[model samples]
Target: MSRGNRWARSLILLVILPHLCIEIYCSKPDPFAAKKKRMSEKVRQMFYHGYDNYMMHAFPHDELKPLTKTFTNSLSELGNLKLEHLSEKYNGSALTLIESLSSLAILGNHTEFEKGVLWLSENLTFDVDARVNLFECNIRVLGGLVSAHILATDSTNRLTKGTYKSQLLNLATELGERFLPAFNTPTGLPYAWINLKYGVMENETTETSTSGCGSLILEMGALSRLTGDPRFEFAALRALRKLWSMRSSLNLLGTILDVETGEWIEYSSGIGAGVDSFYEYVLKAHLLFGREEMWRMFQLAYIAVQKYFRYGTWYHDSDMRTGRATYWQLTSLQAFWPGLQVLVGDVTAANSSHREFYHVWQKFGLLPERYLLDHQMVHPTERYYPLRPELSESTFYLYQATKDPWYLEVGEAIVDSLNLHTRVEGGFASVRDVTTMELEDHQHSFFLSETCKYLFLLYDDSFLVNKNYVFTTEGHPLPILHSWHERLPEAYIPSNWTSIKGEEPKRASAMSMQICPASMHNCIHGNVQLESVCHIPDARDDHRCLSDEDCGVDSTSCRRRLCSMAGYCGQWRYH
Candidate 1:
């Protein structure tokens, strides 16, 4: 061959080699894709394993006694802290099946979801003599039914296409009507426990938790929207307003209250069992219904909580009137607060609390029911781990927000922990004692409804791809359709807070195309920068600051502002 031909061939090789290397780099399979698929399947199997066992051993009952390999008629016993109201004649209304309906849909088991819906529509009744907790029933049964009905009717799912009716909605409406009698008191606060068959039970306890009264709006409002009946939403809204009005001057709420007198029964409150869902529902109701009033309420309440309840990464109970610290402890349910913070674009604060919660989960095999922060020990009696989904739920939300692979690792660790310590032959059981890792007799319905569902979504979130959904506190998904509400209002800063006018709110949502905090800017959705609506620029001039707090967060980037050496707020350096 000629020397010129050899030189030309060498030049061609150089160009081809560089292109080949670029292709190789770009074409490499996503490391997480296969692992995510595997985890997704693992979650699917875990869900079905528990679900199949519930079908076999606890069909029609409220929950599975995994340890006993039997059933417990537990609907009436739920929230019965004293176990005082077990009804002998009350038959199971297929509580586990109701709870499992939306899970089945999430797992892509449309056939089973359809079958479950049909069976429930035909057989279930709220007429039994069982006295049930209003909160539990609304969230689990009514929320589940409404969610499943929406899924059934949604064309995307292609579920129950030809045979579909509004059966679930009908049942939900019936349950909502039964709930109405509980709201008949002069104060508009519903009783905590009400007999489904008899209406508010004679001489029923007048006392209820803040959450018990305040968290009813989302489910009931959805019911009113779906059925076009105003009573359910009206009752719930009135109760929420009345409860907000009852807040102490510090804008703090007590743990427990009297339904009839509209008075605080337990003046100390924290972001735990008694009051946690109240905060959750208010914000979520705003997202779900696009109600400006709800957003305003949530903004004030959220700020108040941050000012009083927060202590670095840990939150302690405080007196409602004085905002003085009361109880220095951590409950498993408090884990959900971080997820809420993330939704509001407070990613920095959310990450801080999330790490602490994950540390506790790592310390124990799973999250214990209560950990006393001051003593750095598990609460003496409340040491059980109830297969609660709060940690996993938060992890999923954080992953959606940041798309950080580390959050996926956190989820993987959670899945492994649950399988290792909680999975029983019959189903996943709760830990009777986290210290001993002793299995409890029962698996709560929320395990299927929320725990497995959130874990599965962490891996494969295709279900959320094009949909706008706000998950009910029970983890049931409700679609956010602009057509359903009168108008979807954008969040705005109160006139007192800002002098800026007509600025659009910035984009700030995890994955769903939903409403975000008023101040959130340039939300990143699927790696695409979508412009935010009603954006609020930082009011400070030149980003100058003396303290870290003065260096407020960046509105568009959702990044924390750092104090530069020159004493001005600037973007934090990754290093």
Candidate 2:
């Protein structure tokens, strides 16, 4: 009774099985979709909460004392440990508004972004009697203005349609001019501080961090490109070149140097506060401005960093001159390294380091300003969590690379913690003490510029579709244009070599440039396939090698090349 009917049913089921499978596999509802949408909105509200407060209480000031519902003209005080020479008459520059511009665009608040742009255009001025830290001003103010100007004028910026003049650009140019006076030092390296009103202050201190001397390239370079000035770019580049030249033979830069004498004053350095952005700019400068020079420098510098500073999943402060670990501590700022590593296609390494940071974040409920890695405790006095964005910034980049939901969870935790502990009746405040969860009155401009922006992008990245941008140290977005890029360096050839020959030459992969030997692993570099990463660099005559990597791989035998103390690579030795 059922044989023919069953056969017909089976045939029907078979016909539709493939169709059902396609829908189930391809069109299944995204599991994280609802959660991500919810998280994105939460971040949006966080941004608005802080921004609304700043507008109310700190509208014209550099930052908000959210706890006090007051304002602080913090620009001049940035990087000034002693907060010296802060002008009482320096009312404000609407600094928080400038910092929030790109964040507004990223969050799709065109109306607010446009309003802020117009207000800043009309009201902001740099001619105050205030003295400012040059590096801080360049990254936060100049970078912000230039980015907002680009966004305000871009064809896609629907909010500013037909109502825009190049007001922001003109403002940025004026600010860039002010910065030029600081670079007038004999070394072409800029003074760390400058008086916004009178240029460099009389007998201004000449000592500056490595970053102070080297991190200006991106913002200043973008200023030059947008304004056609070339002065800003040249000044920044000259300083960077002089800074690089001052690096030790290990290719590691020190913590502090004297701009006037072009001499290193503080020899200890690592990829943290005093020197982080310098390393960041070298890689990013190559991407943004198409300079092959920065890439070459980054390769050597990266190798040195990996060799000397990196140990397992953490990096400790090291003596740049000697390539020895000097300070075994984890800094909140160092959290940005994972993101940089991701950009370099070292995702595996990035992930490892990111998880370690997440572990520390879980331990403290916030990343302290410093944690003694060896002691496994917070630094005695450096235990404050200023609500920096570096951890979230790295999480966003790692999520972008892998599309892994775990990063979303990491972001969710960050959002929850920020809302739970930092949020106040007015706006988010800094943690003056992580141990007590005590809040500080001041809200940093970067809290708006980077923290919320990175968290928002982590959950919602539609703003990035079909666009390539390099975010400055201040988290301002600068588009990467084909017109701004130069061609990759030419391929390496062995045609003229007297010794060895092997497979066809390929374009040198910067990630493969190693100054020391390591366990080999793979990493990404565009569409170009690279050798197992951490390969020995090419052996060249007169090349001094401290380890086996400097000797490079044997071309014909593909054997390990050895280095002699005489700074030459020798052939493989038979056992």
TM-score of each: 0.83, 0.83
Q: Tens digits of per-residue lDDT for model 2 on 109-148?
A: 8888888888887788888898999999999999999999
- After TM-score superposition, what is the CA distance of residue 180 in candidate 2 from its true location, in Å? 0.3
Off by over 4 Å in 1: 1-29, 162-164, 487-575
lDDT of each: 0.78, 0.78
Model 2 per-residue lDDT at 273: 90
Clashing pairs in 2: none
Error of 1 at 403 (Å): 0.8
lDDT of 1 by residue, 1-575 (tens): 22211222222211101111112233557668988999999999999889999999999888899878899888899978798766899878899899988888878887888889888878888888888999999999999999889999998888786463488889999999999999999898999998898898777899999999999988998888888787888789879888998999878899999999998879999899999999899877877776656666776677667667766557889899988889999999999987787566555456667888999999987999999999999999999998999999988876665555788899999999999999989999999888899888889999999999999998988787667688889999988778665521223223442323454664433323443322233346567564321212233333344545434444356555566677665556321
